[model samples]
Target chain A: MSEYTPFEMIAYTGSRVLKDERIVFVGTGLPIIAAMHAQLTHAPNLYMIYEAGSLAPILEMGMPLSVGDTRAARKACYLKGLCGAFELTQRGCADYAFIGGAQVDMYGNICSTIEGHNYDKPGIRFPGSGGAGAMAANCEKTIAIMALEKRRFVKKLDFVTSIGFGDGAPDYREKAGVLGSGPYRVITNQALFGFDEATKRMMLLEVKPGRTPAEIQELVDFELIIPPDVKEMAEPTDEDLRLLRDVIDAEGYFLKRVIKK
Target chain B: MINTVSSNIKNISTLEYKEKKFEYWGPTPDESRKLMVNKSHALKDKRMSLKEAVGKHIRDGINLGIGGFVNTRVPVAIIHEIIRHGARDLTLSFQSNSICPELLAGAMILDPDRVSIKRVELAWWGYEIIGIAPMVRYLATNGIIEMDDYTNYGMSVRFKAASMGIPFIPVRDHGGSDMELVNRGKMIECPFTGKNVYLLPACHPDVGIVHTTAADMYGNARIFGAYCTCPEIAMAANATIMTTEKVIPTESIRSYPNLTEIPFPVVDTVTEVQYGAHPGASYGYYWFDMDHIKMFRSICEDFRKTGNKDALKKYYDEYIFGCENHDDFLEKIGYKTLKKLKDMDGGQPIILT
Candidate 1:
């Protein structure tokens, strides 16, 4: 297998995690690329719901730079507005929410709102939760893509923009009035994670080849529930890379970008 | 008042935000209804110049409901006119937007006495793919403006509820998130199912500005793209100032009644301005001008990073204050850029008749 970039690996991993014939509520960038790749390869029946009100768009106009891009609305089966799209999620039509965030905790609560504890004044202000919060609250399962770093994988989030398994309580989601099962998977280039069914804490399911679970644990601020049988993540074949590069993100709008240091 | 049922969100995040009192950011349902009842319901020709339309409704301290989700079909033309008209201490309400609010924020930064945003109630603000909105980061981080955050659905349904003449609507989101505490929404037990549900207060903007694909002189507007909460926003506002890419004949509007997103009665003024959402995409007409958005965003970012208002002021001066209306603004954008953007649209289909 040819070496792939971290974004490609993340996209390929995202595509791998998705099941066929399901709907994914996608944000811009990698999530869209992942859904496109999944459709082109294994999960042709897997459709997408864009927050700007498109469902099952053919994406023939190439990769949409934004979810609100007209290309995202092209040849959509149903196109309404934010209300129509998210109402569908709330009504249980969407199966998976593919999202990204600035910070995440062990329980999978994602933060994309702020880097500082202060709400009014912040050290750095990331974009507020546009649709991820609603998607996380209502979509049956939440799948997050994050850059693996100690600062990002923190013990505490500055803000919980998307709800995961809050406080690891069994009735946390139920009492919070959210419908999602919560925090199904956390995908990074180096590792893939899932929540423990019993504990609702993040569990290391797989790691990249030549990497150790302990090394993955080094990057995270919180302790991950690493099981003994951590398998190596599947590397994207050259064909998968071509599908991602040539077919999905032909303009290198997302796939070819360099990760910020 | 509904008693809180149950929640663990207080223990989840490390955010230490002050508890916001529950209050309507704009008109209450009763006030909105009464305002609608008092207005003339005639199907008169509401066609007016952008200047006149903005002058009539762009008042200080009015809640301005912005239409469009992120970069698509944003009300940039109206925002320019609003900047020129100069509204102070404004309250902006939107689902998600890119250029509209940024333009306003830039104007506020250039001259606060002329234009100011006191607070914003929104889901998100930033130029998608372009970058984080610099003006929002600047204003918010400096504590210059207040913000009430909600999900895209939370804000959209707030307008939807106002349009439906309801006081509040229940949703399943924001209960476990910090939005439940910071935003003016309430969490209550379901009257029927004994389950907890979050209720968002209706958002009835005092003046809603929207740019549409087509509209007649009577202000019956049609949106070809993703509706982007335009229909609800138009109906939710006390007065709606509409700008359209084309002024289709009323005969054409009548030929397809279902195509109308904002009906005649809901809209107060209509201005025919092609490329109305310039820089932002208008699905059937043209695509978003990514370069222009990038250039503007960079300028704003420069101002944010350096606290230098020269470039930002020049941009507003050259584009917004320099122009008489949207036509003048589009003229400055030139035929080539607009043509390229239109070609990029790939002729998405929409019906005029």
Candidate 2:
């Protein structure tokens, strides 16, 4: 078996979670790769709408470097302004939106704004929320992708840049006027997690191959809400790994090269 | 120099203002009156060379809007001129940006004094840094510049509010998010329904620069594809400057009135510059110069690794300073590569009239 990178696993799991015929509102980085993989594999009819205004692009070339990558507009069916694209999401046409963050809470809330408690004087200040806020509020379902680490998988976020499900109470999102049903899944390196319908707390859905439940539990900051039938995640097939390394990421922009150090 | 004023100004009703507790998303009745009044006035032909436009309009510490989405239809020639002129302390705003801001930041234009303090303030309405250029990250991390964030939709709606001459526009997105903390907006209860909505204030830049496929001498501009925020930028800015690949006849603009993105009345200046969105794609005109972009990224990466100012200086010297103007810059890119990019869109070079 060929050794697969954690990024491939994250991408594979994300693609698998996405269903066919769903219009995906995609951000840059890992989400682009996952969407491309899905398009190539199970979901050929997956329509992608980039925040930069390209809609339903064929993505003839490999994965775009960013949502604004020129490839995103190549042969696009419709080109809109930034406002028009989000307006569609607000109208609830987008079934899923893929987002990444610096920190995620148990309720699936994402914090990409700052690290420390103080907003003005932070331990670390990230590039503040862009479209993540709007995507979280409007998209019918949000799929959050992040690195699995103790700090990242926090019990509480430093700041709520995007609300998942406020306290995970029933009708919490509805009260906030969010059109979508908060986060459907949180895909990380070690395992896959889903939000509890009632509480909105993240529950360990499945562990990836070679990684034990105990190993994932160690990494998470919050307590695990493992169900009785917790199963091992399916490993990337030979074909999946081959397509990822060879076709989608032939240039190694995402897989091999670490642009953001 | 050919000079002609735009004679057509349609009579649109100005909105009237009645004191309402709820903030409208568009122009209020009173503000609509001003916009309608502004629309009635004809725009004089203020055509000039790209150099003249930059010199006459741009100033230090100016709030500028560089219009484009990602790599599409960026006003590259105007940006090159701003760099060439050494404009300082610019507060740059964009909804969805690409290489233009990064190039400025990389050239040390954002920090002309070589001090750690940034001369530029970068305000964008997007989630992540979209470009491959490293300057944005460098500025944010090094505390060189003040970074203000807004959602892509939030920023665009703010522009829309400015275009309509409104004080603020109410939006539904930022109600529960922490966007309200950094961004200047208020969560007010809707008087009619008692529901809450975020009210985003209107933002009008000192100058809005956009590149379009064609514009008349009167600055009636027509964008071919993906008219991102050009119309809003044009209407919202105190002054609007347009760079275009071709300057067609006013009759042609009149022929397709509905297709015109920026009407003549809103345009302050127009400069005809071919290949104005190089290293970025101008839809239906040329594809992105990927090789050039790759080279730029490498330069940026090298600078990030070394923390050497000379690396960026060398790039500016080679790409921006070494070239006299847009034509010279295109020449440095060479005719072959330019031809290949243009051929990708099956477009012929616009012959200067």
Residues A194-218 of candidate 2 have per-residue lDDT tens digits of 9777677888999987777889989
- How many collisions between residues are there in candidate 1? 0
Tens-place lDDT per residue, model 1, A1-261, is 787999999999999999999999998999999999999899999999998899999888889998999999899999998889999999999999999999999999999888889998877777799998999999999999999999999998999899999889899999899998899999999999999999999999999999999999999999999999999999999999999989889889888777789
Model 2, B205-286: lDDT tens digits are: 7788999888889988887656777888888877778998888888887777776778887787788888898988876678
**Can you list the residue pairs that collide in candidate 1?**
none
TM-score of each: 0.99, 0.85
Output the number of the TM-score-best candidate.
1
Q: After superposition, how far is residue B131 of candidate 1 from its true place, in Å?
A: 1.0
TM-score between candidate 1 and the true structure: 0.99
DockQ values per model: 0.84, 0.26
Supply the global lDDT for candidate 1: 0.91
| Model 1 chain A: lowest-lDDT 10 consecutive positions | A118-127
